[model samples]
Target chain A: MGPLFPQEIIGEELNILIGFFIGIGFGFLLEAAGFTNTRKLAGVFYGYDFVVLKVFFSAAITSAIGLFIMNQYGIIDMSAIFYPKTFWIPTLVGGLIMAFGFIIGGFCPGTSMCAAVTGKIDAMVFIGGALIGVFFYAYTYEPLWKELRDSGAMGKVNIAEWMGIDSGLFILILTLIAASAFYAVTIIQKKVTAKGDYQI
Target chain B: MERSKKYMNPYLAGILIGVFMIAAYYFSGEGLGASGALKSVVVATTDMVAHDYATEHSYFSARVSDPENPPIKTWLVFEVLGVLVGAIISAAFAGRLKLETIKGPNVTTKTRFITAAIGGLLFGIGSQLGRGCTSGMVMSGMGVLSLSGFIGLMAIFGGGYVLAYFFRKLWI
Candidate 1:
C-alpha cells in the first residue's frame, strides 16, 4: 500500500516532483547543519568537532527506526523500496578511496554540491574534478573498471540478517553505540579545541 | 560584515534529514543521491557530442541507449537540481553566500584547490566502482540496514581516521 510510485499510486511526473522537494529538504538540512563548511566536515577526523558523526549517526538511526515502524504499521512496503546490493569488495575499496577524498577535499559528493552552489571556489573545482573522473572511468571502462565493478556480487543483504540478529535488537545496539560515541566525541572535542589554536 | 547565523543543532538537523529520507522512500521508493545525477550528466553529454561513439562504448551506451528518454530526465537529476536550488536559498537566507576557498590556515589556497580537485576525482572514480557515494550508498543504504552501507561507512570513516594523521596539515 506504500511506496506510492512503485505501487502506481502516483504518476511519474509527480514522483519526480516529489524527488525534487525531497532534495530540497535534504540540501536545506545539510546546509543548516553546517555541512557546507569543510571545517565542520573535516572536524570529525581531527576531533575539533563531531558534527558529522552526530548528524550522520542520528540521521541513520532515525531513518532506520522510522522505516521499521512504518513498515510494521503497514504504511510502507520495505520490500518494494530501492535498497543497495552488497558488493563488499568494491564498496570497501571504493569507500577507502572516498575517505581520502573526504579528508583531502574536505567534502563528500552531496556536501560538495551544497558548498558549490553556495559560492565555494574549492567546491566548484571539486565538481570539475569529479566530472573529469567520471569521464576518465567511462572512457577506460572496458579496459579498467568493468570487471572490478561487477566483482563481489552479493545480493541485497542487510546487517541484521548477516549478523543473525533481530532487526530491533540490532537497531537498539547501534543506538547505544552511537550514544556512547557521541559522549566520547564531545569530550574529545573539548580537549582538542581547548587549546584554542584551531578555529573554524 | 554581518556575522553568519549559527548552525542548527546537529541532532535536530539529522532528524529532519531522516524524516526526509523516510518521505523519499515512501513516495518514490528511492533514497537521496548526488553522484548518480552527475553520472547522468556525463552520459548525456557524451551521447550529445558523439552519438555513435557513445552508443559504441559500453559505459555511455548502456545509459544512453534509451533514446526515448534522455539520461538527464532521471529522478536523481531532478533531485540534484532541487538540491542546488535549496542550498542556494538556504545560503542566501543565512547570508553565508560568499566566494572563497575553505582550507586550513597552514595550507595555501592553491594547495587546497589542488587537493580538492584530486580528492573529488578520486571520489568520482570510487563512487563508480563502489556503486554509490556517501549519500546513495552509505547514508541511504544504512536507512534500510543494508550491509554494503555499513561496509562502505566503516571503510570511509575508518580509512579516514587511519589516513587523517598523515593529512593533518590539510584539515587541522
Candidate 2:
C-alpha cells in the first residue's frame, strides 16, 4: 500500500524530489547534532564524548520501532524495499577497513560531505581521497577484489528471523539495550571529562 | 553571530532523523545513502572518459550499461546534492562556517591531512567492496533488522575498538 514509488503511486520525478527532501532532513539533523565536527565524531572512540553512540543507537532503535509498527499497520510494505543482501565475508572485512577510516579520517562518508560543505579543509581532502580510492577499486576489481566481493552471499536475510525472534520483539530488545547503553555512556562521559586531560 | 551556539540535543536529533528515515522508506522504498552517490559519479566519469573501456570492464560495465538513463541520473546523487545544500544552510545558521583544519593538538596539520586522505581512500574502497557504508548498510539495515546491517554494525564498531589503539594519537 505504501512505498509510493515502488507501488507506482508516485512518479519517478516525484520520487527523486522525495529523496532530495529526505537528504535535506538527514543533512540538517547530522549538522544540528554536531556531527559535522570531526572532534565530536572521533570523540566516541576516545570516551570523552558519547554523542555519536547515543545519537546513532537512539536513531537506529527509533527507526527500527517505527518500521516495525508501520509494517504491522500496513502503512508500508517492508518486503518491497531495497534490502541489502547478507554477504558476511566482504561486509566484515570492508567494515573493518571503514572503521580504520573513521578513526583516521575522523569522519564517515556522510559526515565528510556535510563537513566539506561547511568548509572543513580536511574533509575536502578526505573526499578527494575517497574519489581516488573508488577509482582504484574500479580499476583493480578484476585482479584484486572481484572474488572477495562476491563471496559469502546470503541473500537478504533478516537478523530477527535468524535469531528466531519476532521482528517486534527484536525491536523491543534493541530499545532496552540502547537505553541502558545511554545511561552507561553518560556516566562514562562524566568520568572522562573529570580527568581534565582530554578536551573535545 | 553566536559563535558559541550549542548543538541540538542528540536524542532529539536522533528522533528527527528516525522520522526522516521512515519518510524515506514510505516514499522511495529505500534508505538514505552517501557512498553510492559517489560511486555513481565514478561510473559516470569512467563512461565519459572511455566509453568502450567502461562498457567492457566488468566492474564499470555492470553499472554503466543502463540504456534507459545515464549513471549520474540517480536518486542518491540528487539526495547528496540536497545534503550539501542542507549542511551549508545549517552551518550558516549556527555560525560554524569557517575555513580551517580540525585535528588533535598533538598532531601536525600536515599529518592530519595526510591521514585523513588515506582514511578516506580506504573507506572508499571498503564501501565498494562491502556494498554500503555506515548509513546505507549499517543504519538502514538495522532499521529493518537486516543481518548484513547488524554484521556491519559489529564489524565497524568492533573493528574500531580493535584498531583504536593504533590510531589513538590521531584523535586522542
| Candidate of highest lDDT | 1
Please name the candidate that would achieve the greatest DockQ relative to the true structure.
1
lDDT for each residue of candidate 2 in B45-160, tens digit (9 for 90 to 100): 99998999999999989778887767898888888888888888888888888998888768999998999899999999999999999998998888778999999999999888
For model 1, residues A2-25, the per-residue Cα lDDT tens digits are 799999999999999999999998
Model 1, docking class = high
Docking class of 2: medium
Q: What's each prediction's TM-score?
A: 0.98, 0.98
Candidate 1 residues B19-94, lDDT tens each?
9999999999998899998899889998888999999989887778886678999889988988888888888889
Deviating ranges (above 4 Å) for candidate 1: none
